[model samples]
Target: SADETLAHLQAALKRRRRLSDQAQMLVRKAMAYIHSHYTHPLTRQDIAHYVGMSEDYLTHCFRQELGTTPVEYLNRYRVLQARHLLAESDKSITNIALEVGFSSSSYFSRVFRKEVGQSPEEYRRLKQSSVR
Candidate 1:
Protein backbone atom coordinates (compact mmCIF):
# COMPACT_ATOMS: atom_id res chain seq x y z
CA SER A 1 0.00 0.00 0.00
CA ALA A 2 2.86 2.39 0.85
CA ASP A 3 4.60 1.68 -2.48
CA GLU A 4 1.37 2.24 -4.40
CA THR A 5 0.78 5.56 -2.60
CA LEU A 6 4.34 6.72 -3.32
CA ALA A 7 3.97 5.90 -6.99
CA HIS A 8 0.71 7.85 -7.25
CA LEU A 9 2.26 10.86 -5.51
CA GLN A 10 5.23 10.85 -7.86
CA ALA A 11 2.97 10.67 -10.89
CA ALA A 12 0.90 13.61 -9.69
CA LEU A 13 4.03 15.62 -9.00
CA LYS A 14 5.36 14.91 -12.48
CA ARG A 15 2.07 15.96 -14.02
CA ARG A 16 2.08 19.21 -12.11
CA ARG A 17 5.63 19.96 -13.24
CA ARG A 18 4.71 19.27 -16.86
CA LEU A 19 1.70 21.55 -16.62
CA SER A 20 3.88 24.26 -15.14
CA ASP A 21 6.23 24.02 -18.10
CA GLN A 22 3.33 24.27 -20.50
CA ALA A 23 2.04 27.35 -18.71
CA GLN A 24 5.51 28.88 -18.94
CA MET A 25 5.54 28.24 -22.68
CA LEU A 26 2.25 30.05 -23.03
CA VAL A 27 3.61 32.99 -21.05
CA ARG A 28 6.69 33.12 -23.25
CA LYS A 29 4.49 33.22 -26.32
CA ALA A 30 2.51 36.09 -24.84
CA MET A 31 5.75 37.94 -24.10
CA ALA A 32 6.86 37.49 -27.70
CA TYR A 33 3.83 39.44 -28.84
CA ILE A 34 5.20 42.53 -27.09
CA HIS A 35 8.67 42.09 -28.61
CA SER A 36 7.19 41.66 -32.07
CA HIS A 37 4.88 44.63 -31.80
CA TYR A 38 6.31 46.97 -29.22
CA THR A 39 6.18 49.92 -31.56
CA HIS A 40 2.50 49.43 -32.27
CA PRO A 41 -0.51 49.90 -30.02
CA LEU A 42 -1.46 46.37 -29.08
CA THR A 43 -4.27 45.24 -26.82
CA ARG A 44 -4.73 42.30 -24.50
CA GLN A 45 -7.43 40.91 -26.77
CA ASP A 46 -5.08 41.16 -29.72
CA ILE A 47 -2.43 39.15 -27.96
CA ALA A 48 -4.97 36.56 -26.82
CA HIS A 49 -6.30 36.13 -30.33
CA TYR A 50 -2.79 35.86 -31.70
CA VAL A 51 -2.09 32.97 -29.33
CA GLY A 52 -5.41 31.22 -30.08
CA MET A 53 -6.44 31.51 -26.44
CA SER A 54 -8.99 33.52 -24.55
CA GLU A 55 -7.85 36.79 -22.98
CA ASP A 56 -8.40 35.41 -19.50
CA TYR A 57 -6.30 32.34 -20.22
CA LEU A 58 -3.45 34.42 -21.59
CA THR A 59 -3.58 36.71 -18.60
CA HIS A 60 -3.59 33.80 -16.22
CA CYS A 61 -0.62 32.20 -17.93
CA PHE A 62 1.32 35.46 -17.82
CA ARG A 63 0.54 36.15 -14.17
CA GLN A 64 1.21 32.58 -13.09
CA GLU A 65 4.46 32.23 -14.95
CA LEU A 66 5.93 35.71 -14.73
CA GLY A 67 4.24 37.10 -11.62
CA THR A 68 2.73 39.99 -13.57
CA THR A 69 -0.08 40.78 -15.96
CA PRO A 70 0.42 41.29 -19.70
CA VAL A 71 -0.06 45.04 -19.42
CA GLU A 72 2.61 45.26 -16.73
CA TYR A 73 5.06 43.42 -18.95
CA LEU A 74 4.21 45.65 -21.89
CA ASN A 75 4.73 48.75 -19.78
CA ARG A 76 8.18 47.53 -18.77
CA TYR A 77 9.06 46.84 -22.39
CA ARG A 78 7.79 50.24 -23.47
CA VAL A 79 9.91 51.90 -20.81
CA LEU A 80 12.92 49.94 -21.98
CA GLN A 81 12.38 51.18 -25.50
CA ALA A 82 12.01 54.70 -24.18
CA ARG A 83 15.32 54.32 -22.38
CA HIS A 84 17.03 53.23 -25.58
CA LEU A 85 15.59 56.16 -27.47
CA LEU A 86 16.64 58.52 -24.72
CA ALA A 87 20.19 57.22 -24.73
CA GLU A 88 20.69 56.62 -28.44
CA SER A 89 18.48 59.12 -30.25
CA ASP A 90 17.70 62.81 -30.11
CA LYS A 91 13.95 62.28 -30.18
CA SER A 92 11.89 64.48 -27.92
CA ILE A 93 10.22 62.83 -24.91
CA THR A 94 6.73 63.17 -26.31
CA ASN A 95 7.73 61.78 -29.69
CA ILE A 96 9.58 58.91 -28.12
CA ALA A 97 6.60 58.12 -25.92
CA LEU A 98 4.19 58.15 -28.83
CA GLU A 99 6.51 56.10 -31.00
CA VAL A 100 6.72 53.49 -28.25
CA GLY A 101 2.87 53.14 -28.22
CA PHE A 102 2.13 55.25 -25.19
CA SER A 103 -1.12 57.16 -25.52
CA SER A 104 0.29 60.41 -24.07
CA SER A 105 3.41 62.01 -22.75
CA SER A 106 2.04 62.36 -19.21
CA TYR A 107 1.19 58.67 -18.93
CA PHE A 108 4.55 57.77 -20.37
CA SER A 109 6.35 59.97 -17.92
CA ARG A 110 4.43 58.48 -15.01
CA VAL A 111 5.17 54.90 -15.99
CA PHE A 112 8.76 55.70 -16.89
CA ARG A 113 9.36 57.30 -13.54
CA LYS A 114 7.80 54.35 -11.75
CA GLU A 115 10.12 51.98 -13.53
CA VAL A 116 13.31 54.03 -14.00
CA GLY A 117 13.11 56.11 -10.83
CA GLN A 118 13.39 59.39 -12.78
CA SER A 119 11.29 61.54 -15.08
CA PRO A 120 12.25 61.36 -18.72
CA GLU A 121 13.84 64.81 -18.63
CA GLU A 122 15.79 63.98 -15.51
CA TYR A 123 16.90 60.68 -16.98
CA ARG A 124 18.10 62.36 -20.14
CA ARG A 125 19.87 65.09 -18.19
CA LEU A 126 21.60 62.56 -15.97
CA LYS A 127 22.73 60.45 -18.90
CA GLN A 128 23.84 63.47 -20.86
CA SER A 129 25.75 64.89 -17.92
CA SER A 130 27.57 61.59 -17.49
CA VAL A 131 28.53 61.65 -21.17
CA ARG A 132 30.15 65.09 -20.81
Candidate 2:
Protein backbone atom coordinates (compact mmCIF):
# COMPACT_ATOMS: atom_id res chain seq x y z
CA SER A 1 0.00 0.00 0.00
CA ALA A 2 2.49 2.65 1.21
CA ASP A 3 5.26 1.23 -1.00
CA GLU A 4 3.02 1.36 -4.07
CA THR A 5 2.12 4.97 -3.32
CA LEU A 6 5.79 5.90 -2.97
CA ALA A 7 6.64 4.28 -6.30
CA HIS A 8 3.86 6.19 -8.01
CA LEU A 9 5.09 9.48 -6.58
CA GLN A 10 8.61 8.82 -7.77
CA ALA A 11 7.42 7.96 -11.25
CA ALA A 12 5.36 11.12 -11.42
CA LEU A 13 8.32 13.18 -10.32
CA LYS A 14 10.49 11.66 -13.00
CA ARG A 15 7.92 12.41 -15.68
CA ARG A 16 7.62 15.99 -14.50
CA ARG A 17 11.37 16.48 -14.63
CA ARG A 18 11.52 15.13 -18.14
CA LEU A 19 8.73 17.42 -19.28
CA SER A 20 10.45 20.37 -17.68
CA ASP A 21 13.62 19.66 -19.62
CA GLN A 22 11.68 19.43 -22.84
CA ALA A 23 9.92 22.67 -22.18
CA GLN A 24 13.24 24.35 -21.47
CA MET A 25 14.61 23.09 -24.75
CA LEU A 26 11.66 24.58 -26.58
CA VAL A 27 12.18 27.89 -24.82
CA ARG A 28 15.84 27.86 -25.85
CA LYS A 29 14.86 27.30 -29.44
CA ALA A 30 12.46 30.20 -29.24
CA MET A 31 15.15 32.40 -27.72
CA ALA A 32 17.59 31.51 -30.47
CA TYR A 33 15.05 32.54 -33.04
CA ILE A 34 14.50 35.81 -31.27
CA HIS A 35 18.21 36.58 -31.01
CA SER A 36 18.72 35.92 -34.68
CA HIS A 37 15.68 37.89 -35.82
CA TYR A 38 15.31 40.67 -33.30
CA THR A 39 16.37 43.18 -35.92
CA HIS A 40 13.24 42.48 -37.93
CA PRO A 41 9.56 42.92 -37.27
CA LEU A 42 8.35 39.80 -35.49
CA THR A 43 5.30 38.52 -33.73
CA ARG A 44 4.46 35.78 -31.29
CA GLN A 45 2.96 33.84 -34.15
CA ASP A 46 6.24 34.01 -35.99
CA ILE A 47 8.16 32.75 -32.99
CA ALA A 48 5.66 29.99 -32.40
CA HIS A 49 5.90 28.90 -35.99
CA TYR A 50 9.66 28.91 -35.92
CA VAL A 51 9.69 26.87 -32.74
CA GLY A 52 7.04 24.48 -34.01
CA MET A 53 4.73 25.16 -31.13
CA SER A 54 1.41 26.88 -30.85
CA GLU A 55 1.56 30.53 -29.84
CA ASP A 56 -0.10 29.97 -26.48
CA TYR A 57 2.26 27.12 -25.59
CA LEU A 58 5.27 29.12 -26.71
CA THR A 59 4.17 32.05 -24.60
CA HIS A 60 3.61 29.80 -21.60
CA CYS A 61 6.99 28.14 -21.94
CA PHE A 62 8.82 31.40 -22.51
CA ARG A 63 7.24 33.06 -19.53
CA GLN A 64 7.80 30.02 -17.35
CA GLU A 65 11.46 29.78 -18.28
CA LEU A 66 12.39 33.45 -18.69
CA GLY A 67 9.90 35.22 -16.45
CA THR A 68 8.95 37.69 -19.20
CA THR A 69 6.71 37.80 -22.21
CA PRO A 70 8.22 37.33 -25.66
CA VAL A 71 7.49 40.87 -26.74
CA GLU A 72 9.13 42.31 -23.65
CA TYR A 73 12.15 40.14 -24.24
CA LEU A 74 12.34 41.33 -27.82
CA ASN A 75 12.14 44.94 -26.77
CA ARG A 76 14.87 44.41 -24.21
CA TYR A 77 17.06 42.76 -26.81
CA ARG A 78 16.57 45.71 -29.16
CA VAL A 79 17.42 48.10 -26.37
CA LEU A 80 20.66 46.27 -25.71
CA GLN A 81 21.62 46.50 -29.37
CA ALA A 82 20.77 50.17 -29.32
CA ARG A 83 23.00 50.61 -26.29
CA HIS A 84 25.93 49.11 -28.17
CA LEU A 85 25.31 51.41 -31.11
CA LEU A 86 24.99 54.40 -28.86
CA ALA A 87 28.32 53.72 -27.22
CA GLU A 88 30.31 52.89 -30.34
CA SER A 89 28.64 54.45 -33.38
CA ASP A 90 27.91 57.91 -34.70
CA LYS A 91 24.44 57.04 -35.91
CA SER A 92 21.61 59.30 -34.89
CA ILE A 93 19.18 57.88 -32.36
CA THR A 94 16.43 57.69 -34.97
CA ASN A 95 18.60 55.70 -37.34
CA ILE A 96 19.77 53.47 -34.57
CA ALA A 97 16.18 52.89 -33.48
CA LEU A 98 15.11 51.87 -36.95
CA GLU A 99 18.26 49.85 -37.43
CA VAL A 100 17.33 47.82 -34.37
CA GLY A 101 13.79 47.00 -35.61
CA PHE A 102 11.88 49.68 -33.79
CA SER A 103 9.04 51.04 -35.93
CA SER A 104 9.24 54.48 -34.35
CA SER A 105 11.92 56.44 -32.55
CA SER A 106 9.52 57.56 -29.86
CA TYR A 107 8.55 54.01 -28.98
CA PHE A 108 12.20 53.02 -28.97
CA SER A 109 13.04 55.89 -26.66
CA ARG A 110 10.24 54.93 -24.34
CA VAL A 111 11.39 51.33 -24.09
CA PHE A 112 15.01 52.39 -23.74
CA ARG A 113 14.20 54.70 -20.89
CA LYS A 114 12.18 52.00 -19.16
CA GLU A 115 14.98 49.49 -19.46
CA VAL A 116 18.07 51.67 -19.06
CA GLY A 117 16.78 54.52 -16.90
CA GLN A 118 17.97 57.18 -19.39
CA SER A 119 17.00 58.61 -22.74
CA PRO A 120 19.06 57.46 -25.69
CA GLU A 121 20.85 60.79 -26.14
CA GLU A 122 21.59 61.04 -22.48
CA TYR A 123 22.88 57.49 -22.43
CA ARG A 124 25.16 58.12 -25.37
CA ARG A 125 26.57 61.31 -23.86
CA LEU A 126 27.12 59.63 -20.55
CA LYS A 127 28.84 56.71 -22.13
CA GLN A 128 31.02 58.94 -24.27
CA SER A 129 32.03 61.13 -21.36
CA SER A 130 32.89 58.09 -19.30
CA VAL A 131 35.08 56.70 -22.08
CA ARG A 132 36.99 59.91 -22.65
**In candidate 1, what are the lDDT values of residues 1-132, reduced to their tens digit?**
234234433544454453466666666676777777977888999888887888898887766555567888788889988887898789999999999999999999999999999999999988888888
Worst 10 residues of 2 by lDDT: 1-10
- 80-119 in candidate 2: lDDT tens per residue? 8899999999999999999999999999999999999999
Q: By TM-score, who's the top model here? A: 2
Error of 1 at 24 (Å): 2.0
Question: Could you tell me how far off, in angstroms, the CA of residue 97 lies in candidate 2 after the best superposition?
Answer: 0.6
